[model samples]
Target: MKLGRLNHIGVATPSIADSIRYYREVMGATEITEPFDLPEQGVKVCFVSTPGETGVNEALHSALNGTQIELIEPLNSESPIAGFLAKNPAGGQHHLCYEVPDIAAARAWFEGLGKRILGSTRIGAHGTPIFFLHPKDMMGQLTEIMETPKAGH
Candidate 1:
């Protein structure tokens, strides 16, 4: 499997609005987009860009060079983010998403090593196909493998 790059760092928060303010005002980070509800994932998320003093719209669309910090607040108790927050009340880093050239190949590689997957491959909140490898099988951290869309696709 050809691993592409570090896609984004997912942060599970109790409140999306509060998290956005914390990242923008306190951390001096730029808000890339307003909080968008992902019904499929049962959470509201806001992407914040890493660089630049002023928040620009282009930052949200450009995924190649910039790194995005994803703030996720679950809408329901059954949501994965909510489950994570329930486990850790303080709300911390949830998962790290890495871009891969082929999700099938990546999944096969991990399964070949006898690692357990949290679930089957599914479309992620960001519209990328993704799957999570169980933390118990990993080094005490849940790892996400995602396949980003091609230029024309």
Candidate 2:
């Protein structure tokens, strides 16, 4: 299957509050969405616009059509993000997300290539289907494949 757009870079942080501060105060980010929790995913996440990109928070219309930075922090000890933070207390890039026209097609293609898909497709922070690819098959970077959101989402 053909790859789609680079959606967002996922960052695992020990604290979303701290990361938000860094993006806003030091990085001068002006368009950050408020942090929200995904209990099913066991993380709290926020989206920060890439530096100098406007309309990052305008997802309903006119938002940046390219890459974004997604800040994720563990919601509890059992959270998946907790393990990431344990390995990196200072936090770092956790994964790269790319949009796909059809998630099932993408999954099938990856499986055909013998790439390990981490888990069943699940609803992600964007309210769309998403799944992760193991870093081993992806040159040391965790990859997230997401179904492109429909218009008006």
In the range 1-153, model 2's lDDT, one tens digit per residue, is: 886778899999998999999998998888899999999999999999774356556653333454689999999999988998888989999999999999999999999999999989999999999999999999999999999999976
Candidate 2 local distance difference test against the native: 0.90
> How large is the C-alpha RMSD of every model relative to the true structure?
5.0, 4.3
Candidate 1 lDDT, tens digit per residue, 56-121? 476444545556788889989989888889898868899888888888989999999999988789
Q: Compute each candidate's TM-score over C-alphas.
A: 0.84, 0.89
The TM-score of predicted model 1 comes to 0.84
Candidate 1 backbone collisions, by pair: none
RMSD of 2: 4.3
Off by over 4 Å in 2: 51-64
Q: How many residue pairs clash in each candidate?
A: 0, 0
- Angstrom error at residue 40, model 2: 0.8
Cand. 1 Cα-lDDT: 0.81
